[model samples]
Target: MPEFKTEPYITDSHHHLSHQDFSSDIEEVIGRAREAGVEILIEGGGEVALPYYLKNCLSDPYLRNMYFCAGLHPHDAMNFSDSILDKLRSLATHKRFAGVGECGLDYHYDNSPRDVQKRVFRKHIELASELKKPLAIHARKSYRDVFGILEDEGVPEAGVLFHCFSGGDEDLARILEMDGYISIGGVLTFPNAVRTREVISSVPRERLLIETDAPYLAPQNVRGKRNEPSYIRYVADELANLWGLPVEDVYFITTYNARVFFNIDIDHGGDIVYKLGDRLYLNVTNRCTNRCSFCIRNFRDGLGGYYLKLRVEPTPDEVIKAIGIPGEYEEIVFCGYGEPLIRYDLVREVARYIKERGGRVRVNTNGIARLYHGVDAIEYVSNYVDVFSISLNATNGEEYNRICRPLYKGAYKEVLKSIERAKSLNKEVRVSFVESSGADLTGAEDMAEALGVSVR
Candidate 1:
């Protein structure tokens, strides 16, 4: 955390603290924000709050950098009242007043007439322009119309945050060209989330800000439950990982961008993704018997995560506990830096648990479980595991030995023997090759076909 000061400065660029989900423990939520190094909490909402209530909430100094926006949501546009504008005018003059909106079109579920939604959206933008304050917008499935209005009315120079940004490359390009900042949430944590990852990775760090959009879009780690500001770190970590920068640099640039744009200073320190389950990762073992040159753990940072740590290799009970009950994941990968067969009991416990509970499992191996663990390990493991993905980095023994650089003698022969046994198992056994020189691509495929195992 380069901004690794006493506390990381954070500005929660977009959120809806007014939602009912906060009623149970708004103070606890705020406490979590504080603990996570969030200093400023900018509050905004859809047509959710009344103008009068929003005013008092914004006026409270204890709500450090607390702010409000007034707008008729696309769904609530039909119920827009003239008095709401009158109440908003009262707060717009206050210095804490930063923006207007959370208003935009929702073509996916047209809750309000598109024309009515447009009318209300324009009024909010007009209000923002008049106040010279930034505007926070919510646009979805209506980019053309939303941008059309901003262009038509000559949207103010004041900052505009595109909340819940979920668009293709073209949409992002358009918004970036307009000098608009995009706020992202939990969607980035989904498995194989190429689209959101692509958008976040490519977006300029100076123009990027993150939000939990709490009580909604809680993220994959805390999915199917309420979301809060504490989980924003997962978004931060994912973005940091994608950009190939230290989490500290990400915190520095994004938090700064957030404050300047939203006009609030919030702290963002000690944030970590407490929840996990979007990308299925397995920490097979830390004590690898063989030290491959290309092993990821060989790097300094070594793909570290807050929870992705190992004090001592977890026993079967500990590993099973970490895995939780059965059917919670798409794939239970047995591939770790260490050999899966080393902990035969760990696999037996988890595999049995998952088999009885209807879950999918996979084993990424060096294709030599039999020699080390004995022939029976494969017979029993194949009974419970779903997929066995074997690494075939080379086509022959000499190359395999050269590449894997195995410690044990005859490791290559052991790999071939393991593959042969796996082919006869009840699981989908496959051999794979990392693109390498002396890698007989076609010959490997032919060999795989003969072995009755899929080749990648």
Candidate 2:
């Protein structure tokens, strides 16, 4: 195998490395994975042979980089029993056990009764909840039932992952809405997987994972061959193309996501500058002017994959230093858990630095700067900002006040004024609304149209 020195080290987020097919040369496969720059392997195990593999396999130094998750596969749901659950609970006690699945509904195969699959999948959900481990789910032609069961069972607090995801656009939306992560495999590289490619491209890299599903579903380039962790690069390459990113960016983003999802050790200490796709986002503050009901930080401290809850906000100089070279990214975005305009000075400083260095600058704001800091605030920032992404969030002040709950009265009017002001300056301005918030999307669009700006 050729070495991948230039590519970033990646993780095979889900794989059956312990399957019987690799019994003859498992060690050599690991060696090849290492050679391919695969730094981590998440092994999905739930078969009867797992005990034997655990007893004898983990002693290898290579296995140290491997984490394991165990549960009954949907095909084997018929064999599930309380005793098997007991065995799984025992396995969960293992120091290396990371999650509780590779289990869900697979109606396409029907190897197990549909009812039995649902029941066993619920058990795995409960077990994962009890064990405080994330879930690695398997759903094939069963996304509806799988999502229904998850909603009914109450998704595990630890987290949930859809392994080898092959869902449609609606399914993908539902998964992301629930903050679930999806892992893609070699199927992405298939010429006929047009739907898969389209849906996967819409997924934020922060919510994506790459896997090879070894001994099965090898990529198009190696269609007849047995898949292994080393082939994860093919999946990464496909995802990179779909997301319009460098393959190394996909590797870094997905690997970071996998580590965070599986609760693996990785330094995610409130990143000041974080990369998502080709844009670099600066998390300048955790403070915001409005307490929007749809804000994600209220439920979780992270977005996409990076931790955004800052204990201490970075100085403008510190942020500039963290950014390294501004021109390296497609755009430097002033967006994070908080509204960037809350620190209008920091935005001016950092955006100026980015713009001066031949980089494009975009500010994601709540449009409250004009309300608090006066008209000049927007005018000054407009000088350096290439684009303004303001959150309209609602159709009118009544709805805005109810949904956003801004600290000041007439904040919605100020937001509208800010949008009009930005447009007057010929700034590339777009307004965004949260669909899940019961916000009036059509009204927001009309408002944006009246203001002569685009809606995002």
TM-score per candidate: 0.55, 0.70
* Per-model C-alpha RMSD: 14.2, 6.3
- What is the model-wide C-alpha lDDT for candidate 1? 0.69
* Residue runs of model 1 more than 4 Å from their true location after superposition: 1-6, 48-61, 265-456
Residue 432 shift from truth in candidate 1, angstroms = 45
**Per-residue accuracy of model 2 over 113-145 as CA lDDT, tens digit each:** 999999999999999899889998999999999
Q: How much does candidate 2 score in TM-score?
A: 0.70
Model 2 weakest lDDT span, ten residues long: 1-10
lDDT string, candidate 1, 122-160, tens digits: 888888888787888888899989999989987767868
How many collisions per candidate? Answer: 12, 0
RMSD of 2: 6.3
